[model samples]
Target: MGFEQLAALKDQLAKQAEEKRMAKRAQHAKPAQNAKPAKQAEAPKQAKPGRAAPTAARHAQAQKAPAQKSKPVDPVVLSIGKLQKRFPKAFPKNPAPKVPLKVGIFKDLLEHSEELGLNEAALRDAIKVWCWGSRYWACVAENAMRVDLNGQDAGQVLPAEAARARGLQAKRQKTKNAAAQGGAAQQAGADQQGSAVQQDAVVSQDGSAAQQDGTAQEERAVQQDVAAQQNSTAEQDVVAQHDDGASQQDTPAQQGNVA
Candidate 1:
């Protein structure tokens, strides 16, 4: 072959090869371009919320849930518990029975508060709670002996103090009974209101039923009247048919007689 023809043939083959590569690349790229926009369209619009970060908020309460969560301990109660351990005789635990204490025992407790790691206010509150219980009042009879921290007798219970203790005990009991009665009365009132609502509902239902029954009776009466009217019309039609037949028979008889 001639050199010119050979060069032209080589150029044509190269152009064809380049076109095939471009076509294959475009085919591979088309699906990717279409899929990218589709994926963007399917994406969610709503913003994702952050996991709970603590903010200052406090509110609701319930009954049994309180038992599940621990409550803050009272400072006075903790102080009293410590004193009970140190001086078991003067501040005996429940079920063991309480003993009358010396009238000026607060002064004695104040002296020991520092060693026991108790503050003044908490210690004073503890002493008040310990002395104010029913068992302590029971032990405060006139002429009954008052004991020190070691259970040794220091003084006798005065008559005036004993009388005051009795008054306090009676007042506490009366208040407690009144509170219980109030709760019971509230519950009864709520029950009565519920019963009244139920009765009203029952009355409303019965009235609706009675109204429906009256309407049904009226419909039945109308149907009966229509049936009666139809029967009377049918009887009149039968009578007219009988009269026409008699007239035709009489005419035939007259013609026969005349002939």
Candidate 2:
């Protein structure tokens, strides 16, 4: 309970409190350092090789390409001078040929004048006076046929006569064919007769030639027999002469021995 003892206890308690506070601070600092190192390792894991950022460069290049379009063609133009130079005869419209009475709107004017209820003889006289051709007459005939004539008959009326003429022509053609057939038949008969005559003449000539050949062979055989008989007689005469010469030589030898 003295003052020295109390002061010593207070000093010991103060030193112990200071030592506990320093130990707590060192433990908290060690944990903070380890957390910093763990954070660094996680950063390296997140940023791996396969992880890359996306860019818009390819999309921008596609957008910048130009759009394609088809090209157009131009038309050709010719000058009037060129057209005129190419077609000189066609300039200022081509000149039309004169419409003759036979070809144009003026043919057959006379025959149909009665159908048209006009003075046909007088019209004929007028056409002759005007020196019109047959084409004008034809045109007038066609126009007259087209006219309304209150049921008047206007076609040609000679059909029976035309049919009679055709019948006569057919008859003439039939007669000509009959005559041609008769002539051909006669010619064939004459050719057959001529061939028969030629064949008979050839047979007669061949028979005469065979007879002549047989006679020639018989004559040659007779000549050979006569020549063989003459050769046998000559050979017999030669043998007789040789025998007479041998007898005369024997008589001469006997006479010499008697002398």
For each candidate in turn, the TM-score is 0.50, 0.21
Cα-based lDDT for every prediction: 0.67, 0.41
Candidate 1 per-residue lDDT, tens place, 60-155, comes to 233324656578898878888898899999888878888888766777778898888987777766776677657877888889998887788988
> Where does candidate 1 stray beyond 4 Å?
1-71, 206-259
Question: Which candidate leads the pack in TM-score?
Answer: 1
Model 2 segments more than 4 A misplaced: 1-158, 205-259
Tens digits of lDDT, candidate 2, 79-106? 2122223323221112422111222112
lDDT: worst 10-residue window of model 1: 250-259
**Backbone clashes in model 2:** 15
Superposition error at 184 for model 2 (Å): 1.4
